[model samples]
Each structure stands twice: as structure tokens, then as C-alpha cells.
Target chain A: MRYEEYNLEDLFLLAKKGDGTAFEHIVRQTEKQIYNLSLSIVKSNEDAEDLTQETYLRLWRSLPDYKGESAKSYIFRIARNLSIDLIRKRNRTPGSDTVILTADGEFERDIVDHDPDIRPDEAFIRRLTIETVRECISALPPPMRELIVMRDIDGLAYHEIASILEIPEGSVKSRLFRARERLRALIIEKNIL
Target chain B: MSKHSCKKYDFMIDDYIDGLLSDDDVRKLEAHLSTCEDCRQSLRFSIALRNMTRSAALEFPVGLHERIIESVNEDKKAKNVGSKRKIFRLGAISAACMLLCLCCTAVFLMLPGNRKSESKLPPDCPMSEAATDPSAMLPSFNGSVNAPEKGEDEGYTYPVIEEPALSSPEYDENSPEDAAPTPDETCAEPEEVAPNDKNDYEYSSTDAPANPAPDVMTNNSNISDRLENAADAEKSETHPVASPEGVPSARPGGEEITLALLIVSGLLAVASFIAFLISLSSIRTHSSNKENKK
Candidate 1:
């Protein structure tokens, strides 16, 4: 079955029961996201794979502990924990890739020039938007960086991000609000949005 | 539009981007944004940043799953093998220690003469006679002095005690040697007078010997006598005096050969056990660290 058909809890429960197929399907689904999260923190392809695998193994074992909550939030929680651990173990600074894209680099650089699925004109706009977005996100301090990641990249709701980050909803709102405002300025300055 | 005036909009910007505003909050925020061009610009920047971060995809390489599973399996196997090695090493060490004790006991036993033979010898005899014996000598010399006269005798005679090298030589031997004069040149004058007077003194005192070598001979005879005594004690199944001073010690003093065998075996066993333990611990610690990293 496609991993999309089953929620994270369903996949977790089945995998915990030693279902190799479910385990494989779950890995197939989440591996890319987990890998990306790990890569963002660790900044190494090999280490990212190792972190993703560890995340999956933990997900498999901890599936039985799922309490019928928001599957996306729960999975993101797991991913965040595993990614943080991997980064810490490697002793790498989070968002260390910030220097590669400077403030005005967004406007000067092409964005969707790297997109796997690209149309002719949309590619240029997508590329510019993406670069501006990446640059803007990179410029944020760690608190904002994490807030945006959970809310946008991982797609968790305000409550979900707050719970995962262990902050109040008000704080989440305030933090996200600042993060977005900063992004909008960067977009305007870069003229990509 | 002033930079100082933008502070009020700064705090609310993150919440606005996250869509956390209620209907009234949104209306108020929108109303503020509509009137404030600077706030509007700030809101747009926040939106762009969120969109960019969300869209960035961190890609994983191929075959990560199989590699991770393989690593875990290998680790578990290594741990299992390592534990068995540790157990084996521990067993070997205990066996070795016991064997070493046994061998030492046997070595002490097999030397039937021990200190009893020395007591039989003349008190004037320097302790270096054992090193001077021809059979115990090896061509690969360590520049050790074998002869010690009375003058040099104080520090030199018990070279075994002084040198440390002579006592526990690379080789082991137990044989008797000739008694020579002490290095004190002045003692040569007294030496001529002392032996004659010593014989008379011994005859008058011990009432056992009229001959010159009788004391030396008597000492050899006592070794056999002590051996016999040890045997009798063993026959009686009582603890025998192993020391020449008649201090009571471990039982079975006469069977040195048997004790030596036990000691060698015990020592070998102990060495193997210790090596095994070190190897196992190293492996375990290595694997445990690997597991932690994974």
C-alpha cells in the first residue's frame, strides 16, 4: 500500500508488529523528508542517511506508543528529535549553510533553475521565489528558523508547532509573525515575491 | 514610515505570517497594515521567508535503510561474540591464578634442601657459593663476581640481595659449591689460626665432629634429614615445617617437581585470562560507542 494512504500512526502500528512491507513503505515515504531535515542540521549526505535510518528505527519501535494524536505532528516530533540528536552528536552548528546565500544573493540568483518539475517561465519565477525564500529563512535567528520549519516545511499547525517546540501558542504566533514579516521584506528587497 | 515607528509592527509580524490572528485581530492588523506602508512591506518579507523554508527539500541518498539495518545486525553480532570472549577470558584468569599458586607451592616443595641445608653449613661460609658452582654458570656472563672474601663479604656475599639480578636469574639451579676465603686480606693472618681454633671449638661445643669438613657434611646430611622429616610429617598428614628456621608453613614440602608443574600451568592460565579480558572489554566498549552513535 502507498504510504500516503495510511496515516503515520497506522504505518507505525503495523511496522511495530514486524510488518516488513509497512516498514519499507513508511521508510520510502518519510526517508526523503527525514533525510532533508538531517541534512539541514548535520550538513552531510552520509550522516543524514544514518540519521534518517535511526529516525525510522525509532519510529518503528515507538509506533506502539502513538496515542491517536495528530500523525503529522507526531512524525515531525520524531523527526525533530532525531535530527537534533544527529546534529548534536556530530557537534555541528544548525543553519551553518547561511553564508552560501547572502541577502542580495536571492535577487541575483536563479531559483527553479534547479527544480525537477519545471515549466519555461514558471521555472524562472519559481527559482527566484525559492532563492529569496531560502535566503530569507537562512537570515532568521534560530528561534525563527525552527518556527518557520515546523509551520511551513513540516506543515504543522500553530498548536502542533507550539507543542513540538514546547512554547505557548501566543509565542508561536508572535515568533511566526516576525519570521513571516522578515521573509516578506527579504522577498521585496530581492524582488522575487 | 520612520524606522523608529516600525517597532510596534515588529512584534506582531510573526503571528500575522503564521495566520494565528482571530477575525477581530486580523481586521485590526489589516487595518494597521493598510494605513502603514512600512508594516505592509514587513508583512510581505515574513510571508516570503516562510514559503521558502517550507519549499526547501533536503534529499537523502539511496540505500540508507539497508545500511542502517546491516549496521545494527553487525553490532549485535559483535557484542555477542565479545561477551563470550570476556567469559572465556575470566575463566582463563581464575584458572591461571590457581595454577600459579599451585606452581609456587610445588617449587617451594621440590627444593628438598631449602634453608635446612644452609643451617648445616659453617656460619663463616659466604652466601655466594651457589653462584660459583660450575654447573649453574653460563658463558653469557653478566660480569657478576662469584668469589667474596670476608672484607668484601658484607655487601658482596649476598649478591642475591644486593644485585636483585642474581637472586631471580633468567636461569634456575640449586647446587652446592666450594667455600672460598673472604676478600679481607688482613683476615689471612687470622684465617690460619681460626680454622684450628674453630675445630677445637666445634668439638668441645657440639661434641659431634673431629674432622675438617664434618660441619659442611653435616649440613648436607640435614637436608636429607629435613626431607625425611617432611615425608614423615606428610605421612602423619600434619602440617610440616618448610622453613629451615622451623617455622611452620604449607604442607608437602619435599615434592618440588610437582609444585613446579602446578605453578607453570597456573601462570599460563592467568596470562591467557587477562589477555582475553582486555580484548573483550575493548571490543565491548567499541561496540557500545558505535551503538550510541547510531
Candidate 2:
């Protein structure tokens, strides 16, 4: 059976027992989500890549002590915490912000067109390119940006986001709503339509 | 574009976008959206935002996987080396402590005060017998002039005087060239007599003859009077005398040095054993880790 078919908890248990293959499988499964979470928070490809590697290293060391119910939340929590720490350290040192870039050093050119049957204004909203959307998201306040990334970009459930953020689920919903509203306002202010 | 006047549906827009609205709420939102062009634009923006963000998930950098794996392996190797070094350091410390303890033990055993014979007194000594027998009265000296008697009502115990051995060549009986002189013939020179010497002479005066020359008696009486005055002035002070068991007389400071060394050795041995145990446990852990890797 493919390693992805194995239960995450089972994979974690095997990894705890010093199974290198199982651990690698876990890394492969969670690396994209961890990377995206890091990138969204730190906003720099290089720093995000480093944070992703660091998250895995911390996971390997702390695996034996993990008793949490969700392995996915545990991994994402590690990435989030590391990204926050890096941001705090950067804030202490003046002139530390480096140029940010996507992994391929350029934005994706082909935009996915929206269906007009659902909303009559769908084609009008599609005028805002993916790059423009990313710029708008990056311009958001850190709390709003984090909420949007975890909820919309990474597609984590509200409860999972709450668990990762150590907040109540109701707070997650309110904050996420505000983040989405802010994002929509930013896109509208861009006058792309 | 005009702002939507339907303020009541602002919160439901997100629930509707997330597919969380009930059938009834959806119908109400749809009915309101049909008349509200501004709200329809807001819904389109939310959908576009969600789509673009989801599509914007960053790709993992090429070769980062291999690098991460390599870094993990390197970290593991570094940790193993670090633990091994720690164990070696502990083992070295344990060995050094054990060596020091052995050296201290050797020095302690060689000390003069630690000799078995020197720690005890000669059995033939009268003072030793008196000291050993707690109920025994102090031995009276026949030649002690005006020896204080044991007063029944007085709680004071008289101090014991030890005679200096007359083993010098000048007093040797076997050498005719150095024949021992009679007590009267051995007149001390007035110029050579120190103030302290008078006290010694007074203590030994009881051994003298009952009838002696008037000049000698007068001189001895003068010396005895001076000695009595000095003793009275210092009556409040008591000096520590050598014990009859020869415990204090066995090489000054030797026993103390031996005891200090013994205590030091004992502490060092304990520390060394503790370090050794720590190193042994670390070794076992390291081996177990290697076994798991295998």
C-alpha cells in the first residue's frame, strides 16, 4: 500500500519507533502545507524554506513526546511557531527585510477563469490576477494575513485552525470573516475590475 | 458602484461562501442578492479571493528534500559524537579522582601519628595507670616539697608534673669519665639561672638534703620565694599538658593531617564513583541508540 494510505497516527507511531522510511513519508505528506504556512507568514521564499526544514527537525526531536490527537495540526503548529519566532527576530534587527519571491522566482502566468453561472460579476472579479491577489494578501495586517492564510490558502478547518492557534473556534470564525472582508476590500480598492 | 443598503446580510455572506448557510438562509440571501447589485459584487470578490489564494500555494524548492534529509543525518552524527565525548570526559575525571584518592591513602598511612605503637602510652608509667583507672587517686610523690594534699572539701585537682629524662651523657652512670654528680655537688651558676629555671629548681628542691649549708639554703629560699611569686601572679592561667596516653605527644599535627587526608579521599572516591556511573549509563544509552538504528 502507498504510504499515504497509512493513518497519520500510525505513521507517527512508526516514526517514533525509529522507522526512517515512515518518518520520510510523514515529511513528504506535510512538507507542502508546512511550506505554504511558513511562506505566508514570513513572506520570503528563502526564509520560508529554512523554516520548513527547521520544522521537520523539531518534529523529529519531539516526536516521542507527542500525544496530540491530530498530527496535521501538530506539524502546522510547529511551522507557525517557527515563522512567528523568525518574524520577531527580524523585527529586532533593523534593515533585515529581504526581497520576497515565489519558488520559481516569478508568479504563475495562467489564471484560472471563474464560472459566470454562479455569480454575474464573476468575470469582472477575475480581472485581479493571482499576483495582484497575493500582493493584496501580503498588504494585510499580520493577524488578518495569518487568518486568511490558514483558513483560505491552506484550507484548514476552523476547528483545526483554532487548535493550531490555541484559540476558540468562535474566535477563528469571526477573525476569518474579518480577514476575508479586508481582502475583498483590498481587491476592490485596486480598481482592477 | 453604490454600497449595498442590506446591512443585515453582511455576516451571512461568508457563511454562504463557505457553504455553511442552511437552505432557508441561502434562499433568503439569494432573494436579497437578486435586488442588491453591490452584494452580488461582494460575493464575486470573496469567491475570486478564495480561488487565487488557494491556487497561490507555494511549491517546495527543488532539492530541499535531499538537503533536509542530509541535515538531519548530520545532526544525528554530531549528537552521537557529543555524547561520546561527554562519556570520555567523565571517565577521565573518575580515573583522576581514584588516583588522587590512592595517593592520599598512601600518605595518610605513612604519617607518624598513625603508627600503632606511638598512639599508646608505656604500661609501666604511673600516670598512665592513674589515667586508666578513673577511681584511682593521684599518685603522691615522696620528694615533692609541700605537695598539696587532697582536700576533702576542695574540688580542685592538683596538676601532675612530669620529670625530664636525665639520659644526657653528663648524667650517665656507666661512663666513669661522665659520672653522675650528687644533687648538692651540682650547683647551678647564678649567672646561668633564668627566671624560669628557678621554678624548675623549686619543684625539685624536695629531693635535697634536710640539712644543708646556710648559704645554699638562703639562695634556694630566695629562688623558691621568687618562683612562688611568679606562680601566684599566673594562677588564673592553665596550660595544656601532655596526656599520659601519649596521644598528644605523637608527632604534632600528624594525626590532624591524616584525618583531613582520609576525609578528602573518601569524598573524592564517592565523586569518582558517581562520575563513573553517569558515564556508564551514557554508554548504555549510546549503544541502545545504535541498536535502534541497526
- True contacts preserved, each candidate? 0.47, 0.56
Worst ten in a row by lDDT for model 1 chain B = B186-195
Q: What TM-score results for chain B in every one of the models?
A: 0.34, 0.49
Q: Point to the candidate with the largest lDDT.
A: 2
**What is the C-alpha DockQ of each candidate?**
0.24, 0.36
* TM-scores vs. true structure, each candidate: 0.41, 0.59
RMSD of each: 19.6, 13.6
| Count of clashing pairs, candidate 1 | 34
Give the per-residue lDDT of model 1 (tens digit) for A109-160.
Answer: 2222112121123233344557556666665544456666666786667787
Over B105-136, each residue of candidate 2 has an lDDT whose tens digit, in order, gives 78777775454443132454332332333222
**CA-lDDT, candidates in order:** 0.54, 0.65
lDDT of candidate 2 over A1-193, digit per residue (tens): 6667898888988787667778899888778888888877888899989998999999988987988478888888999999989988887221222333245322223222222223336665757688877887877656567778888877788889989988788878876766666666666666544
Off by over 4 Å in 1: A1-4, A65-70, A94-129, A135-143, A178-193, B1-19, B59-294
Error of 1 at B232 (Å): 47
lDDT over C-alpha atoms for residue A185 of model 1 = 49
